[model samples]
Target: MANTFQLEILASDRPFYVGAAEQLVFPTVDGLMGILPGHESMVTIVSPGELKYLVDGEWHYAAISEGFAEVRRDYVLVLGDAIELPEEIDAKRAAEAAERAKERLLHKQSIMQYYHSQAALNRAMNRLKISKRHNHEI
Candidate 1:
């Protein structure tokens, strides 16, 4: 059996997951990053995208918003702005949010507002894509 490591995924509002995982893969500012048991310790910026983890030989997926991740030799801690199982995502809501964000971007706004809207759009689109992809399996 593959070696396992402790993994704890935390959302801003609540705990998302906590258990042993054989492997973990998540989007990072640079790109997709994978971690396994005894990974080197480091911290990195997590991008808004799909996060996957292997547990008991099964792969689990979740949509996660931007945040940070801390990797240790035997443990990995993820702190995300938001995180949701594919089934938990509401496609309609996500689409609506994406539209709203797009509209906001079209209008004149401060730099901060523009950046916020862009981030919101990215998160909403990512959630929508993940939701759609997993809807058939659910």
Candidate 2:
């Protein structure tokens, strides 16, 4: 069996990461899902949350927005609406966004609007949490 798999993470604006990874873990609609090399092929809806990948014995993390992932035996592809490394996250901006999303939720709008607001809030909160955890670990 292979020890690593090709991992590619693409954001709407640009390619976020492309390299060989020993393992990968990310959020899905059902919950957290993990992938290993030589895994079965499948596709899944990725939820907004922290994405972790192991490369060269080190783990790297990123915050990813809603997207889809295509998994194959030797490769995986992630296409997210947005993706940001821990260092790239702005805690202050994320916090502000979270507050705005919360306010929008409280106002109560159409179902679509409510869903959007909830998604926004989830993304912002995930970013903030990841940013804080990364900073503290440094």
Please provide TM-scores, in order, for all candidate models, with all chains considered together. Answer: 0.95, 0.94
In order, candidate lDDTs are 0.95, 0.94
**What does the lDDT come to for candidate 1?**
0.95
TM-score, predicted candidate 2 vs. hidden true structure: 0.94
lDDT for residue 27 in candidate 2, whole number 0-100: 96
Which candidate number has the best TM-score? 1
Model 1 worst lDDT run, 10 consecutive residues:
129-138
lDDT of 2 by residue, 15-128 (tens): 999999999999999999999999899999999999999999999999999999999999999999999999999899999999999999999599999999998898899999
Where is model 2 more than 4 Å wrong at Cα?
Answer: none
Q: What does candidate 1's lDDT look like per residue over 1-138, in tens digits?
A: 579999999999999999999999999988999999999999999999999999999999999998999999999999999999999998889999999999999999999999999999999999999998888963
Q: List the residue pairs that clash in candidate 2.
A: none
Query: Which candidate tops lDDT?
Result: 1
